[model samples]
Target: MFFRIINRIQPCTSQQRLLSRSPALQNSLLQQFFDDEENFGKQELRAKKRPGRSWTNEELRLKSSEDLHKLWYVCLKERNMLLTMEKAHKATARHFPNPERLDRVKGTLKNIEEVVHERNDAYYQLETGDSASAPKRTVTSFMGFTYEKRAEEHYSPPGEGQKGYEVPYLDDDAYLMQKLWNEKELCKERDRKDNLARRQLANDEMKHYKRGGRRTFDRLEDLKVYQ
Candidate 1:
């Protein structure tokens, strides 16, 4: 009976010694792994770090298709992460650093779309019957200048004459009358100002000539003798 009790006590003592010897075993035994002050400090330090900024075009161009695809996912994840962080910050009444990161992500997405469009346009022009360039229609403006209007796909019925859509007539009697009246008035005003300016210039020249003749009055006898 005494030997059995001693063996049981020896096993319990050995187990305690083993637990104390290993930090992991001690933590497992106590259930206090995360309760350490150093780990808590490290967590706080990691949380304080700001994420990287926007991606450049060169960097994006250099990336392979696989990399670009992965980048897209990463950008999406980053946007979501920022949003979540922003929400949490707002909840906690703290200022979020680098708020423009969301806008940068949006700009990057737009750039990606632009690049995709360029590639699609090149591919479509090579394979399809239609040109990738924008369709244009010649239109006469109110000023009688011909301009090209961009053509877009539409399913609406043609308005008025079916042969060709009638451009709303700016040459209607009322509109023409108003335009002619304005033009005539402008021309008349311009002519009146021009004539006034010419008359003033002529008068100034006459005065200058008279002053020259007066200055040469002492030479008037020499002039008569020569005559």
Candidate 2:
């Protein structure tokens, strides 16, 4: 299946595309900085068809490397275009059309990157005998518990030639204080639950009484039957 997918992929291009501004948008050299001339300072919003949703990870996974490369640029251009129009609108005190498009564009870019990373990891696993996942290290926490921690990109694992954190020693006094606090919290929670259950029981009893031709309880003490 992997070989078949690879065979279906087209050759990726090496040329870099311009951001936001397409070649056809260039009426003059000065217009290259913006997406399009009509995009800037357009206050009136046209209630035409809304934009489509972003490319999902599953859809991107089925695409070829060449398709992903082109898609990345398309999303990048859209993000840039959105930013440009937003800035223009803000400067002129006008509303930007479809402000949510920026978020959608960013989501699409993220999906593309995730799909590309999956492919790269698969390729690495096929060629090399290891996965291309982030590096993990076993480290002991301040609570004296050991766990495997995955290191993010451009970050080193904690306690790896770094100044380890200083945890205050737990003495008898600290233990007693923590125990008291836990007991107090537990008592509060129990009281809350008991109050809620009592209230519910009273409400149910009142409902039953009303159905039995009793409009109201004789006294406040009558509602304390649960006690």
Candidate 3:
């Protein structure tokens, strides 16, 4: 059956040859397919087309594993649908409606993942020798502070001491001396400004006190109050 299907895919016909020979025609067909699929998927997944409230916890609990798997695919399709609508909106200078629907779908998917993970964890802990969880470590850097860490795997080993890739801290005496000198200068400048401001404020207050002292008390009533 697969051989028959394979045989059905004929070599380039004369018309197909003519079409392929023109790069413009070939590109147009490719672009048409791309645009059509994008629009079709968006239309299919639009909230109006699928119209329902958010998934309920009861619905999730009742779902079989296979149904849950299908739901994941549906969520993925919905996300792609939103993204397509967004891109189309940007292209045509229009607003994409109901962006919140995407977020709601995402939250639903995350809840589903959590439930799946809980099940997987329980199963692994029961059957496996260890829990299938990420490994963690405590690491210290040049400044000398330890912190909990996670490991990352790379397809290729990273180049050590590569410029721009890794920058090491300079803890040399010369660097430390320069840093201390800069700090001292900044501190001295700040102190000088603060002192000048304080002196100006004190002078203003003293002037106000002297002016008040020289004010005449013309009223006999005020003089009696002072006495």
Candidate 4:
């Protein structure tokens, strides 16, 4: 993927002769992995700027599917190369310039994915009356906690790659346990509300007393009593 983009980039003239003479030129991966510099290791290291703005969703949506696919790989390869360069610079205690360049690439990739997902959803809806979005269901864990589980692809079937595997489903006992837990939580919540209401009432009484509205028999006790 890197080689394909490098072959397409014709502007780097100074490195052309050097690249032609290098034995690694025969290997596309090695040739494109390294920066095209004659004085690569001999000179001071500095951050390099990315050439242009990231692809916008409008621009990507206008492109053909094949073109979008090609662009996605190109951005992916460029991101990998940038990260590799940054890693090397960090190892040598050198500063990498314009770290926001990575964010720009990442944003573009995210936009591209959203566009692709939209298209997929539209196609599936048209053909099968279903969206391409992953299916999700409410599932209870072995510990009796319930959560939404989104479907995903795995290399192996469930319970295949791990020991003592438990499917995320609740039995009658688990349901009963969860029900009891909820009841306890509700009781705690009601007690908290009652305490809060009493505190508020005490505060109001204190305010009334401060305004000289309390009688001699009112006691005029501190609000801390309610707490």
Clashes of each: 0, 0, 0, 0
Please rank every candidate by TM-score, starting with the best. Answer: 4, 2, 3, 1
**Best lDDT goes to which candidate?**
4
lDDT of each: 0.55, 0.61, 0.55, 0.65
lDDT of 1: 0.55
Show model 4 residue runs off by greater than 4 Å.
1-31, 35-52, 152-227
lDDT of 4 by residue, 1-227 (tens): 43333342222455456445556556777655555443233333343423567888888899888987898888888788677656654555545555566788888899899899989999999999988998776665766886777767669777854423345566888878988999999999989976676556555657677643222334546533443
For model 3, the superposed segments whose C-alpha errors exceed 4 Å read 1-53, 56-59, 153-227
For model 2 the TM-score comes to: 0.53
lDDT of 3 by residue, 45-138 (tens): 5544444555766668777779889998888777775665556555545445555667888877887786677667888889985555665655
Tens-place lDDT per residue, model 2, 1-227, is: 22222122121222112222344334455343344433333344355434778989989878899989998987787687677657755654556667777898999999888888888899999999677788676665544434677755656555665533333454566566767878899999988876676556555667777543233687988656433
Candidate 1: residue 214 lDDT (0-100) = 23
What is the lDDT, from 0 to 100, of the residue 43 in candidate 1? 18
Candidate 4 or 2, higher lDDT: 4
Q: What is the C-alpha RMSD of each candidate to the true structure, in Å?
A: 22.5, 13.9, 15.8, 11.0
Give the TM-score (vs. native) of candidate 3: 0.45
